[model samples]
Target: MNTSPPTAIVRGATVRFGDVQALDGIDLALTRGALTVVTGPNGAGKSTLLEVIAGTTPLTRGTVDRDGAVAFVPQRTALTPRLPLTASDMVAVGTWRRAGLWRRLSERMRGDIAEAMERLAVLDLAHRPFAALSGGQQQRVLIAQGLVGRADLLLLDEPTTAVDARSAELILDAVAAETARGATVACVSHDPRLIDTAAVVVPLDGGRIDQSIRDAGRGRPRCPA
Candidate 1:
């Protein structure tokens, strides 16, 4: 049994937008150094669950308690072609959480950014315009942004979707490496490869949890739904 405290805990979480309920009574705990995959059909509230954990979405009821820094990478980002931001610039956004907007990045921060891009196999794309990159390249760059901070809690939505096999492999390996380095990783993905390797699998439907499955070979026991 891994006795370390959970990185984050969501208790009795619920979210409602007018007549639509996005999440209902979700109770979950994200284990340190473990990967938890959230899977479900469209409108299953999977993304909403991540938002709640990221503290970007407010709950209609219940509470969330979390520790350390959090990095959230959404499924899609809108970057204007007119902005002229390079791939390296996009990855550098991850450092802003700790470095703030105005402070110049230290040498170590720059190194970390470079390391993250390399891990995602996007180091070569660093000088290219972010908006000009292909879908796979853009996704890889965005994930590198999430990794540059070495956040305690890393949240990603559908990271491998619509990407080439090589890109998908790089993304999966990078995510796995984060957990290996003791980050709590929760990702929303339909990829069977991710699901098979996840420490915990969370299935949500109609704004409620169907169940929580902890792989017999990974992490701790199953969390109560």
Candidate 2:
């Protein structure tokens, strides 16, 4: 790790959507180079937490502050089903920060995209239309997209929900590599098996985090709860 401070900080965070209290008094500190897995059942506010960290969700109370750039790959991307973009094209969008919206890609950028696709085992699907891919394939491609360019904070929601065992391993391996390289990677998943690899296993229930488990991961890591 580069000795950077927490990549993201959430203090007494709360989010309300209509009648739903998505989050309640959440305090989280996402440290750099840690792979934190946020686990919970459906409606446990996992997705909302990711959005809040990414700065896309409006909080009803509390605060979320980031130390650097953030990249979020929602469990389901909002890309229209009819868009005629290829899987590779979708992943390349990660490099848009450097390759302007309408600009061309240089050799270096192309290499980065290729490497990211390969990491997720989606390099062979480069020519396939994104919408035409299976659910698992689409999920892998979306993950590759979030990794195309290095972001200080990388957020993923249920990244392996639809993938098979092999693909899930690849995705987790890639996420682990990102944390090893100094990115704060926060993943939301319901699979408890993931705890075996996570630096921090944060279990959410009733819109509140289990601080006992969370505090253990403050500096010393342990297996999932």
For 159-187, candidate 1 gives per-residue lDDT tens digits of 99999999999999998899989999999
Poorest 10 consecutive residues by lDDT, candidate 2: 216-225
Give the whole-model CA lDDT for all candidates, comma-separated.
Answer: 0.89, 0.84
Q: What are the candidates' C-alpha RMSDs?
A: 2.4, 3.2
Top candidate, metric lDDT: 1
Q: Which pairs clash (backbone N, Cα, C closer than 3 Å) in model 2?
A: none
For all predicted structures, in order, the TM-scores are: 0.92, 0.89
Candidate 2 lDDT, 193-220, residue by residue in tens: 6666676777887788855454443463
The reply for model 2, stretches above 4 Å from the true place, is 1-4, 77-79, 211-225
